[model samples]
Target: MQYFPVFLNAQNLDCLVVGAGEVAARKVELLAKTPATIRVVAPQACQTIQAMAEQGLLKWIQREFDPGDIQGQQLIFVATDNHQLNCDISTLAKAANIPVNVVDNTELCSFITPSIVDRDPLLVALSSSGTAPVLLRYLRQKLESILPARLSELAKFSDKFRDKVKAHFNNVNQRRHFWEDVIEGDIAETVLAGDNQQAEQLIEQKLQQDEQTEAGCVYLVGAGPGDPDLLTFKALRLMQKADLVVYDRLVSKPILELVRRDAEKIYVGKKASLHSVPQNEINQLLVDAAKQGKRVVRLKGGDPYIFGRGGEEAETLVEQGISFQVVPGITAATGASTYAGIPLTHRDHAQSVVFSTGHLKDGSIDLDWPALARQRQTMVFYMGLTGLNVISQQLIKHGVAADMPVAVVQSATTDKQQVVTGTLMDIQQKASEANIQPPALIIVGTVVSLREKIG
Candidate 1:
């Protein structure tokens, strides 16, 4: 890092700006956001700065720079167009042990302003240390999009409860654990969701829960289907307090973006033939993260319980007696069904719906085809892309009509989503022609015919 990050106590501090042109005016405007008393010294002040000075918002010195301008100031800025004056101020500020910024003149600057994302109580200051302001600004914009607007309010909310949480939970270790839960728990979620009343209620309940449990636990979160909009409010709420997120491969990028930026993100993503991190290792990672008194969110694609192996992860948490809860999500089947205009279950079309995984841990389509076919209800198959041929054949042999309508939805809820409808006999071929792949949903039943009705 080229620059050391520090939050200066600007309140009551004297900060001097030596120019009042647009560039200097911009700096002055940004500094006005803080409580620091600002002094802008320039022979010519901009209309805005002059207006501010007239309104008593700032102290303006309409005179040329004197050596005395550098005296008694904790921080100073030389935003003038004169390079010589900037260099002179830099030398003087350095001699007085004061931090000085010479605007764009990095060579003369003792300090440089960062590309900042201002969330008031939750500020993110990004600096390339005068190396790349454009790149830093680009990154700042991306962070602004991903960060919730209410984060500042949430930070303030946390400050309000800090004393209560500390005093209520006397044991330091226990208090630490309790805070992990509070941050990742409902209070943070409510703020993010813009539900202040519920957030406050959750905070109160969390404090009560802290009193009941000596040590707090963790939560394994299912990030839901690909679209962040499909995420349950509960799931999004749990993410605010995440100290560590163990994410899977199929988890969406936007969903990962919702996690706390400071939270540790560990990729536990697994592929069909390639395991980046094995299932057992993922289980251990979750356990280890929680044991450290950190709020661990095991972010998986779709509903964690539905072919997500979330149950297996929960077992590991249970074995260790880790305090954890499962927040369900819009599974691939539901997400695909809705996004593709196919309902999982309809009173007029189908009485029931079934969700089945096509591929097992051993990479085989081991399922009861006969019973699955005889049910005559809508069957939503997840991870069935690779095994589509066998799935179609099995259902046909097991009394499901070869001509039964079928629909394949790939990359459901995403911009690249594809939807294909055909008979069971040719659905696989049709899906192949459409280049449908995994991380998809397949619905088989007469209900597939209703996509036109719903459309």
Candidate 2:
């Protein structure tokens, strides 16, 4: 590591900033986040900074920076265009044992500003040691998406119970374990959902309960179509805190990589005519893991309720009286169709959309051909690649035009995504020629024609 990361307490410190241009304004904006007294020395100041100075937010001295300007400040920021002046300020600050940051000059900086995701008490900082600032910023952007905006509110709410919790559980480990449960359980969920009063009550209720015994629960999380980015915030939180993750084959590798590193992963994925682990056994596995007082995550691809058989697993959990939470994900139909540039319902084309499964338990494709053949409605078939011929034949046999536009999106939303478009008369042949695999979605309707315009 080129630099050790540490957060400074600016509440009682004096900060000196020497500049008035855009760079200096940026630094001042960051400093405003803290409680430090700011003093800016520049020949001229930007309108924003001047307004701030007028508002008594900072003390601005309209003059060139002098060496004496560094005398009493605890932290100094040199953002002036003059390199010599910046270096002089840096040397003076260093001599006085003050920390200094020179904007855009890594070598002259005693400390570099890290890209921050500020959730008040819950702040996450990313830095590349000045070697890859853009990379650090990119990571910050990714984290910003995954983290809930109410995270800071949750943290603040939790802070109120620290003392009471500590008093209830005298042992440090006991208190820590209790907090982990509260954070990963319904209490955190309620707070993140913007119900602070309920969260507080839930926390108090948990505090009154016996902390000696820990109950294990399961979270049925949808990993979304192939892209890890599509995973929901609640899903990501549960995945990271899980003690064991029971995942399916349809779950993408990138999404699986986000699971807690120390958590055990059990593959219960099923392929066509091949079951690595039967559905019953997978349900039993979840029950067994949860019974052991482990936080278990049943991670599946796409929406768990949508043909993912999540209802079955949930039923088993209910039968066994095991507590579980279901977190919905972007179903493949919506994700794949959108990424393939085939809108399921367009105002001018498809007024309604229907989702259907092409694969069945008895290895037969039994669908409502009459309803599916209705006009002005788009049909999205999940796990339908294998039953494409049957679907195509059935749709055409039931008054649907064989020339209706159809598009098959394979590995949707991923880098390897492929879209194969053809008419109902030739879609199966086109899919076969393209070697489109399972986990692909089939869209049928006039909206399929819109792919050419938008794709």
Candidate 3:
């Protein structure tokens, strides 16, 4: 480490800036974000600095560098075109045992400001210690996206109850465990989700309890077709905290790899005519794991409610009275269709869209053929590859054209994705010729014809 990182207390801090041009203005703006008393001395001030001073943001001593400026200042920033003047200010501040930062000059400085991400009471400071500034900024942008905006509120909420919680627990270890449960449990989640009232109630209820229950919650997260990038922030967060992950076959390998490193995983995905793990067994697994105080993630491919039997699992959770949260993911049809350059509904080609499962239940794909055969409407079928011949014959028999444009998209949104476009009469043959795999989507409509144009 080139420099040790410290979050200096800004309350009642005395800050001094020896220059007032653009570079100095940037430093002033950062200091202004805190409750610091600022004094800037410069011969000529930029418009930004002048505006800040006019608005009572800081005290501007409109004069050249003065040794008096360093007096009583706890922190000093030297940002001047004159190298000698910056060096002189740095020497004065360092000799007085005050921290000084000479912008762009590391050797003359006592400390350097880092790229800061401010979330009120919660702040993230990242630095390369004046080296690799651009890389530091890039890292800052990444952190901004991953960090929640309301994290400050969550931190404040915890702070408000710290003393009360400490008093409630006689042992320090017990208090530490309580805080762990609060921050990692639903209380912190509800707070971050913007339900502070509910969080407060939960916290109060927890305090009144004689003992904390070992019952853990379940998260039904959609893996979003096959793309790892398509996972939601909530989904990612829950996945990382998972003590156990129950995933499906359709969930891509890349997406599956994102689950918590130490989390236990079980594959309950079904193959055609084969049940790897029965649906009822899978439901029971979730309830049992959660009852054992395991943070369980029931990871599903695509939208779970959409043919993924997510409703079945949710009903089971409800029946068992297990606390759970559902994080939605992009369904296969929409994701696959778009990546194949086949819009589900277009102004001229498709007026409406219908989603159906071609997987036969009891021996036949029992869909309303007449409604599905409507013109100018796009038809998407999940698990349709096996019943492609039946689907084609049924649609054609139900007044649909045999030459209706069709597309079969396999592994949608992934590097291995493949799209086979042909007429309904010939798509099955084309798909077979290319050896298109399962976990594919069938998009049927004139929109499939636009693949050549838009794709």
Best by lDDT: 3
Q: Residues 20-93, candidate 1: write the lDDT tens digits.
A: 99888888888888889999999999898998889877899999989898888999988888988888889999
TM-score to native of every candidate shown: 0.63, 0.62, 0.60
Ranking by TM-score: 1, 2, 3
Q: Evaluate all candidate structures by whole-model CA lDDT and list the values in order.
A: 0.83, 0.89, 0.90
User: Candidate 3, which ten residues in sequence have the lowest lDDT sum?
Assistant: 169-178
Q: Report model 1's TM-score to 2 decimal places.
A: 0.63
| Model 3 agreement with the true structure over 1-455: per-residue lDDT tens digits | 77998988999999999899999999999999999999999988999999999999999999898798788899999999999888888888889999999999999999988898989888899889787999999999999999999999999999999999988877553565588789989999999999999999999999999865556789999999888988999899888878889998898899988987877999998877688998999999999988877789999999888988889999999999999988899999989987888889999988899999898656569889999999889999999899998999999999989999889998899999999988879999999999999878898899888999989
- What TM-score does candidate 2 reach? 0.62
**Candidate 2: clashing pairs of residues:** none
lDDT (10s digit) by residue, model 2, range 209-308: 7657567899999989989999999999889888889999889999999998877898888987789998899999999988877889999999999999
Clashes of each: 2, 0, 0
